[model samples]
Target: MKTYQDQIGNVLGLKKTPLRIVSLVPSQTELLVDLGLKDSIVGITKFCIHPSSLRKEKTIVGGTKTINTEKIKTLQPDIILCNKEENTKEIVEACLKIAPTHVSDIFTIDDVIELINQYGEIFDCVSKSSEILDDLTNKLTNFQQFIKGEKTIKVAYFIWKNPWMVAGNTTFINHLLELNNFENVFRDKERYPEVDITKRSSVDAILLSSEPYPFKEKHILELQKKLPNVKVILVDGEMFSWYGSRLLKAFEYFKTLRNSI
Candidate 1:
């Protein structure tokens, strides 16, 4: 048997080729299903709601950060998939104690493509993964063309509401913003940080995400009132967060979003 590994800390040890797998990250869980590993996936987190039909068939382990160790052990996964950002270090350590685990840490488009290739190799679906990657690359290129020479709009992308946290420089959201000719106002911040409304006034736009906190249309009106000059838009969280096959469609979405802005 051979073993394979990726730069993002994901490792695939070929013993029996991972017949039963558990995916903790919602985005990665969806990616596995996209890669045609639906039957091989035995367990998923309660938060993995994409491909809604899988919700009925897959065993629910728990959330990404917290999992029922006993229940996961009972399912007896040959391989466990987790993400560094989505799952805590403690959770990954606990999962490793039960089975061979692969942890992925992604922050850029390149990292996402590499992850797709790695998953393809592990799941024996390289051609499909390559095709998906090609589609994503093309979309991204087109998005770049569409946004070329556009003024860099200063934008604050809020992920949470109460504490008012906005995506910072190091996150994938920040990268997407840059791709769309939008300069992240909080580039000085290392990660997602709780921001003050007064400080947020400088941005030209306020982007409210549809997940993590499910920012709704009403929230847009609320934010618009607070920041009258800034354009408030409801953005799809998956477009910025999924980092997999979903990225193929995200560029076109971003293009439409840019036009709307």
Candidate 2:
């Protein structure tokens, strides 16, 4: 038996390769499936919808924040995958009781690369992980070069409406914005918070993400009416939030988006 420690300090001890698995985070769950762990995955949250086929076959334990512990216990997974920010502490504690759990906490690209390497090692798919990481790194480098010396565009990324929440400093979206050479106007705020429209006039662009609330083109038109000078764009939420293999294409999408702007 060997014990494997992930970047987040969770130990995965197994006598043999884990045959039964459960995933809590939607992005990581999709990554597991992408890594060819489909048959091995016995349980997933209702929100893990990347591979639509898994929705019917895999048992739904619950949502990301609220998990059904009893249903998960019945499935009897040998390994459970979770995220530090997505799942609650109580859910991780409960899953630990049923199986060896690996928790991932990722913020920046470096952290994402580390997680990809660690996942590869854990799943005995080191080559695949390396390939994905290399591709992502190269693409990110190209994106950086493409945007080098470009004028910094001050932007505000809105994730929610009604209360009008904007992505702030330290968030993944903010990091992605910086990568694209766009300065987040709400960086002064500690985290995502409801923002007042009066303060948003200083930004040159307003980006509405297609998640958390599914902001659409109509939303952009609505925002344009409010802030006539600022350009409103509908951005993909997954490319900004999904910190897995999905990042491989995120840079290209960002480049196209930048061209549009």
Candidate 3:
């Protein structure tokens, strides 16, 4: 057995190399595959669709928030991976009964790097982890340089509708928005807050995200009707919110997004 510490300061003891793994977090699941643990991963959430073939090859344990503990236990996972924000405390407790669970809490890019590094040690994929980290670092540096002189735009990034919610402070989406030189109009609020755009007077643009709520073009017209003067655009939510291997391509996407704006 080997000892491992998760990002949230939880310590777990894992059977060496964890041949059978269950991943509940979509982004972390993709990172596990990129770190060369694809075949070792015995189960994953239905939302882990990155490789596209993963669901066919691995057992679907459940969604990020709603996990099937019985299904996960049946997989005989030696280790289980989770994210603090993505999974509930109940899910974590249930997984602990089935296998050693490593829960990650990430806000910034540095947290992602550290999580990848820890995965490398636990899964014995040091070289692959280093390669991913190096690529992420270089891309981040390039993006920083690319966005250096760009004007910061005040924007409201919407993650949901009906009630109409948007990303606020202390979230990964907010962190990426700052990185992209897009100042969040709701930066003062906490987490994802429901808002009345009619009341928000300082927004320069309105970005509708493609996930959590999957904002459509028609929705653009709806929001535009409310905030006629504001620019409303549909954005890929994965680019701004997904951490791990996806970030390798995200920097390039950010550059294109900024150019278009």
Candidate 4:
């Protein structure tokens, strides 16, 4: 058996290469497929909807936060893929009982690239992983050029609405916002801070995300009533948050979003 360390530096002692794998994160699941490991995946969460064919091919082991331990045990995966924020500690502990669990802690683009390289070593797909990394680098470079000379837009991104929460500092969403030259007004606050939108300060734009809570057109109109002059648009949550293979398409989306606003 050889040892492999995940992005979180958790050393996993396993065989030369894992045959059966379980993925708990949606973005990472898509990344695994793009890395040519689709055939090896035995279990995945219901949220791993990317590639569109995984649902018919793999065993559904429940959602990201709530996992079925029994189903996971039956799959007997040689390795389980998880994320620090996506999965709970209890789930990680339960997963360890069945197989080696590789937990990823992603916060920046560099971290995503590092995770790709780590997966390359863990899954014995170094060449394929390098190719994906190069592609992502090239896309991000072009995106950098696309955003040149664009004035920074101070914005507030809404992910949930019941209590009114925004993507705060030290989050992957905030990092992407900065990449697109959009300044997050709540950057001073911690992760996912709750706020009273009615009493909030001024911002150039208000972004409504399409996930976790599915902020829709009606919601946009409601926020518009409060801030009549501010630009409010529905943003693709995947492009802003999903930090795996989805990143390949995100830069283009950002370009379009910037142009539209």
Lowest summed-lDDT stretch of 10 residues in model 4? 195-204
lDDT tens per residue, model 3, 33-88: 88888989899999999999999999998898898888887889889999999999
Query: By the lDDT metric, which is better: model 1 or model 3?
Result: 3
Per-residue CA lDDT of candidate 2, range 1-261, in tens?
879886678677888778898999888988887777788999999989888888899999999999999999999988899998889999989999999999998778888888888778777888888778778888888888999977899998888988999989988788888988999989999678899866656888888888878998888788778788888899988989988988877888998888888
| Candidate 1 TM-score over all chains jointly | 0.95
lDDT of 1 by residue, 181-231 (tens): 888989999888998866655788888988798999899888778778888
**Best model number under lDDT:** 4
Misplaced by over 4 Å in model 1 are 6-12
**lDDT at 220 for candidate 3?**
91
lDDT for residue 159 in candidate 2, whole number 0-100: 89
Model 4 backbone overlap count:
0
| TM-score of model number 4 | 0.98
lDDT of 4 by residue, 1-261 (tens): 988787777788987699999999999999999999999999999999998989999999999999999999898899999999999989988988899999999889999999999899889999999999999999999999888889999999999988999999999999999999999999999899998766667699999999888998999889888889889999999999999889999998898999999
Backbone clash total for model 3 is: 0
Residue 73 of model 1 has an lDDT of 98
Model 2: residues with Cα > 4 Å off, grouped in runs: none
Residue 224 error, candidate 4, Å: 0.8
